[model samples]
Target: MGKIESLDFIELGNHPEKLVASSKQDLYTLCYPSEKMPVPSHYADFVRNDTVMLNNFRSFVAHRPFHWAWFLRLLKIRGLDESFLEVPGELSYSLQNPCIVAIPHFGLHMLVPHVLGHFIRQDSMVLATGNEEGEGVQDSIEKILPNDRTRFLKLPDRWILRKLMRGYQSSHYPVIYPDVTSSGDKRFRHLSFLETSIRVPLGVENLSRLCKCPVLPVAMTYHDDCYRLHLGPTLVYKEEGSIIFPLFSWIEELVHLYPDQWFGWNFLHEMIGEAKLLR
Candidate 1:
């Protein structure tokens, strides 16, 4: 008879803790003022060409009277104030707790912070990443975060971020640019490698799966007056073929359905490849 077999499990990655360590450097971890992001190559190129367009789009959003009014309402509403927001799914299932929300790019730029502030009251810490140049925006968030619940994480600095994540035990909702665009720019031709390669990193995905946390497919659009935060459906991976795949499929559908609001002046074009305009 063979000696009583001792069980040993082989992990996927070469260095499992290293996987943990690397994952620790999330976009949200560092305090704004102190964090520093080393600029990635081609980042400046992307910014140089798109600065004017982005600014114009941002102004368009800012100038909207409805946006202003909605923002004012957001300030007055509490985290649990679903009445003020146009929540789409069932209250029993939709972001009623701490969960990861995959918000589209354009709506995320301005409106997300308000959403974060609202949710933090219920102990949900909204996470975002920024470059060294946008430290001011990070600083502004830090100032507004509630002393009891709200917090901001700057992603550039790795060491500090690792410690922070370990201490806080937060979830990752990586903000990624959708691969569809309106512009014809070919700069992002190579982006297919970056785009579909993986939006949610393996480390982050594994963490969420292991923790049994739900992923809320989110997309917001400022249409007419109110800023609509659309919560599609909650995805929980119970087994091998869980709802994650269907959730991603629906996300792509939303992107196509609201291309204009989602893209906002070809930002998605630069980030991902250009969109094929409908004839």
Candidate 2:
């Protein structure tokens, strides 16, 4: 297996008790702040209280095993089936026409390729940041998924960028997570997220402009014993300015709708620290 720098890999087959313990500790460290920040008036409804926060934390912990199980299935260690995924028919067009697919770091995000593989006929690339914590699951994904079908490229590699440009020209779908705290290029914009400003990378918009491809906002959620992939309207690039705001606005809606499934909530405070607050 090839290694990408600063990319940590998750050790599979951990004891259930250990997983729970680690997850609880991580939840406490990241999600529970020592000092609670003031919630903006409009953002109050989206804020999670102690009980809801605990529930969300529990949901986050519970999903890890399922993610590992899905990875096992992908690696052929366990039997795999399509019944576990629910994809919308609307995704057919996007799959057919190569576009930049922007997905949030939501529930079971690494399983995206496996779930969409059944529908995607052309090769696709999944762009991930090398610096983000808890992104070790990506290493498992790279090892399991065949490179020819879906290539996992950690950003900041000039060679990969060249390949991505060529791939887009050839109709290969490039999937990216735009809501990350940091990007490979270190380019970011502090935009309004849940009524508070947090750093969002400009990679997605930059790539879309460079490739001249429309951005397809996709959201993945886990519920009812399956994963659901929802496709939003395609966003075309504008010559005048940045699309990061509108793009993230759509993401905020999804995060609000499925707060428990969103992994961002864990480190959200850190992302928002000292950044400009939205009025």
Candidate 3:
């Protein structure tokens, strides 16, 4: 945990279109998951090299099984913390003040707040799914985290979670991902990601309003043999609606830069209604 650096891992930023050529094997394991697909002529370079494919796969938070998740879980149970931490000085201050860190479900994201827990004095909690009356999701994630510091709420059950937010003597940073669309609830806001309007949950946005704090879009990925953190613009809450465009754009950029690390690309089209249309 020291001075972190910008992503210098791959050349994806210079030529984002190369993803159309990702290796079939790599795409099968990393992005496409379920079955092997014919790689287009253009995307082959994205996952052609064995080293590049595996390295990018290791950077993601979710895994097919034993590859990424189990290894990290073993490390956590053995008391091994993150390889590093990086956030702007002012961003740390915003954490101290009431603020929401809207993390997208990209890369090794679940561990960010857990890593921050070691450095910051303030209490922190990860807001996950509140199903099973907030018990099921909490159990699954809390087991992997450094401590039992996760909360489960339907997220729309705003008043109860709001009270907990108010009680934070210091900032009890509640981390939540807004890009999920596994559910068909109309409560989820519509957002554009890669020319697709996807259903995104507005839990973080509502929580920010309840706490009257600004939202910062944050992302984490392991690369160059270390952890790399990415920060998007801080959005002040507004009555009009959720500040999702900027955050969605940021994730879109990261997804382009690290296409293999984002697991949702398969179901992403479905979430955006593109899959159904094709049918």
Per-residue lDDT for 153 in model 1?
Answer: 47
Highest-scoring model, lDDT: 2
For each candidate in turn, the TM-score is: 0.50, 0.70, 0.61
Q: Would you list the clashing residue pairs of candidate 3?
A: 20-43, 21-42, 21-43, 21-44, 22-43, 22-44
Which regions of candidate 2 are displaced past 4 Å?
1-50, 71-82, 123-148, 156-161, 240-242, 274-279
lDDT of 3 by residue, 1-279 (tens): 211121111222222233223332332344233223322212234455455554445434223322233323333444443433345455555555545667776666554555444434445554444335234323444544426454555544436445446634345655666676322334667776666567776656666677777777777765433556678888877774647667777788887887766655545655666632211
The most accurate candidate by TM-score is 2
Candidate 1 clashing pairs?
A: 29-153, 30-154, 181-275
Model 2, CA-based lDDT: 0.58
Writing each residue's lDDT as its tens digit, candidate 2 over 157-267 gives 655546666778876777777776344546677777776778766777878889988888887777645667877778888862356878888777887687766766555
Q: What is the lDDT of candidate 1?
A: 0.40
- Tens-digit lDDT track of model 1 for 1-279: 111111111110122222223221221222132112122223223344355533433444344323432343344334335554575546334544555544445454434644644443254555544444334444533333233233444445444334333423654333322233221222222212212522222222333465566656666666544566766666676764354355556655665565334443333333443442211
Q: lDDT for each of the candidates?
A: 0.40, 0.58, 0.51
> Rank order by TM-score, top first?
2, 3, 1
